[model samples]
Target chain A: MSRNLLLISTSTTHGTGYLEHAEEEIKSLLEGKKSILFIPYARPGGISHSDYTAKAREAFERWGISVSGVHEYDDPVKAVNEAEAVFIGGGNTFVLLRNLYANKLVEPLRHRVLKGMPYMGTSAGTNVAGRTIGTTNDMPIVHVKTFDALQLVPFNINPHFQDPDPNSTHMGETRDTRIAEFHHHNRQPVIGLREGSMLRVKGDGVKLLGPHTARVFLQGQKPMEFKTTEEIHFLMDAY
Target chain B: MSRNLLLISTSTTHGTGYLEHAEEEIKSLLEGKKSILFIPYARPGGISHSDYTAKAREAFERWGISVSGVHEYDDPVKAVNEAEAVFIGGGNTFVLLRNLYANKLVEPLRHRVLKGMPYMGTSAGTNVAGRTIGTTNDMPIVHVKTFDALQLVPFNINPHFQDPDPNSTHMGETRDTRIAEFHHHNRQPVIGLREGSMLRVKGDGVKLLGPHTARVFLQGQKPMEFKTTEEIHFLMDAY
Candidate 1:
């Protein structure tokens, strides 16, 4: 049975208000699924079990899809194993990585997804699906025991991309400068995702979502911008 | 006639308590100089001109050295040109870099220092002397206009290198893990300096200071640790 996965960059209850479209896309993904489970285990946002469960319930109810909050289950693997599809909400990338490692879910989650289980991740959750967890700029507000992450995607993803903050006083390299520095050493391409956007990967290819632009940075070259509708064929070729 | 240049990482009056030691170091470096002109152009910590001038005056008074604060000079090159040895107080590296670039002081400072003006740097000031400002862990709280550095030292220096925070919940990556990842891509060696420790480069050799340890990391190898008194002969070899 081939299952699908949806990863969202954020799970703000109102959806990405910019396009007023996250809910619609999510509903379309879950429309015909027989079993749906919400895994909020990557609760870096200090989200309690109940809070995450409630958010999942809210989103599911809006779409009229029966959803179960699986975090309450003693064995998350068992819960995930039975689910036809999974949706992960976002908060802090480090928090999510910590939770995933703490729950020993990296391998199991990777296994389920590889076996054709539908998986979805937003924000921090989407960060976990990348090759390395170094792209995140969120503060290490909490310490998780391990630094390993799921290597579903082969490149680093910088979400919530924006220009340099105008009011900051401590002088340091900007995000663009830091990314350029990263490129000086890393050959891997970094994908910068703006707000109200996503990269949908089916099998091995990724497609952009929403109206925002994405930037691809490679070593010794200028960062190239791409539209949301362009096919991310380069990622497959590079990796 | 040689002037004194006292480069400190933090402003002494900022309540960081390193002012006494920094004062002593400066006095030792400028033993025979009777009058010292203080230049506070790298003002990144939101330090007011009067406040910085007063701090320099206090340090000089304690050392029994005559002092003149030159904060009103407006032009860094002009201010630096007349100084015997300039003391650069550190707050943030990026802020310092920005001011240095805006004032066009890199060439003047470099030329003066190379001409046997005893140069001293603490913390962020020391970072500016490095080949590149890539190893700093300071928050990108502000953006500098450029990434250019003074390049007094050939390698990147990680200052205030304490062990990983025990209470931090961020399980993303340890400094070691991040450095390892950095090594995977970057071939340059990173010198980790613990608090109270300093790296002194004279001629072609580098020496460590204070009671802490320095760790040198290179690609494909275990990090090599060194004591404060040890000579970092490898740095000489690199140059």
Candidate 2:
């Protein structure tokens, strides 16, 4: 099984231009690909798909690559079948997955990626790359038929994971507490990717990129932290 | 229509005993009722339902009132129908709603509450009282059949609502941003209740209790802040 995936925590970081922190990695992932298909269904800040696609176009054109939104074509499944690469920008995970199922693109997209077409996603996009969207931080603006996601990876992804702040006064559940709660009902391992962190999976191996360490959560065990330069097999292998 | 609902933002506030902060308001709501049927299905922090019910039992017993978990009865619907009052404590909204649907308690609970049974909830309990559980801050640890909730109130509730921090370095979406995104897909108004805040509904009148102002968001209009003493007609009346 040859699979290429770039799962990112966020599209933008604090005080940085969009995708600026992961620019080099993104370009390298798209090397030798003439054009890429963009899925903007997440619609950050409730933006329209076309407007969101324009933002992606502006970013990728800088790297001498042309971008086309999947919504621009009449047959989205056909677009995925012919695309050289696919990129999904982040927003609301529920909204993205609902639209993905609505267009019947989940299976077609998964099949294409299994054959080794490069695929990359950020935030909500990255969340859908996991087994289920059950761990998303986004509000359920709308409900999908099911929580079943792409299953590109066996474990779930908790994008935008932040460590608990000892000095904070907010009483809302912390990210760690939320993921721990997920394990009570679900058995999948969860990779908590902090800002500026990403997971690159090629074939059976996975690499953690960026400067921060990724937090990994499994059922019945304490969470472990993985640095940018470590090999974690449980992350890439199906549990 | 006569509806007695005490929608609480949280059971506990910063640096306080559980339900200690809202004890007076809760006591006022439950006066004359000898007992309360507690739905501990939310199970905060993955605690057992009996343990959560024990917490509620401890709180109400202090006020000369008694509490029993719905799970204690083999027929939850009968327990709800025969109960003098109902209380749902704080926890994950997704888990809470899924269990509510699984046990077939949604419609029965709604009917009993509409018949003038005193009903109260905190956090996730507060969230399910709205038109839908679409505005909760909790993560989706489990998937529910629908975002459709009890619709006890016309508007949705964003409990534990916090304003955007001006000096924070975090890149995650703020509470305000998340609610704005909710309005893009859903047409219902959303009420943002900060900690130590609650809603009191009786007959055709609605009152905001506690100390903080509630933020009201309607489609195609700027979010308006309403004080505890303000008259909010659109709140009690279904949109």
TM-score of each: 0.52, 0.99
DockQ of each: 0.04, 0.83
Per-chain TM-score of chain A in candidate 1 equals 0.86
User: What are the lDDT scores of the predictions, listed in order?
Assistant: 0.63, 0.91
> Residue A189's C-alpha lDDT in candidate 1?
78
lDDT of 2 at B163: 92
For model 2, the docking class works out as high
Most TM-score-accurate candidate? 2
List interface RMSDs for the candidates, in order.
12.4, 0.8
Best by DockQ: 2
Tens-place lDDT digits, model 2, residues B1-239: 67888989988899999999888888888889899999999999999999999999998998989999999999998998899999999999999999999999999989988888899999999999999999998888888889999988888999999998788877888888898999898888899999999889886677888888999988768999999867677776657
Model 1, residue A200: displacement in angstroms? Answer: 1.4
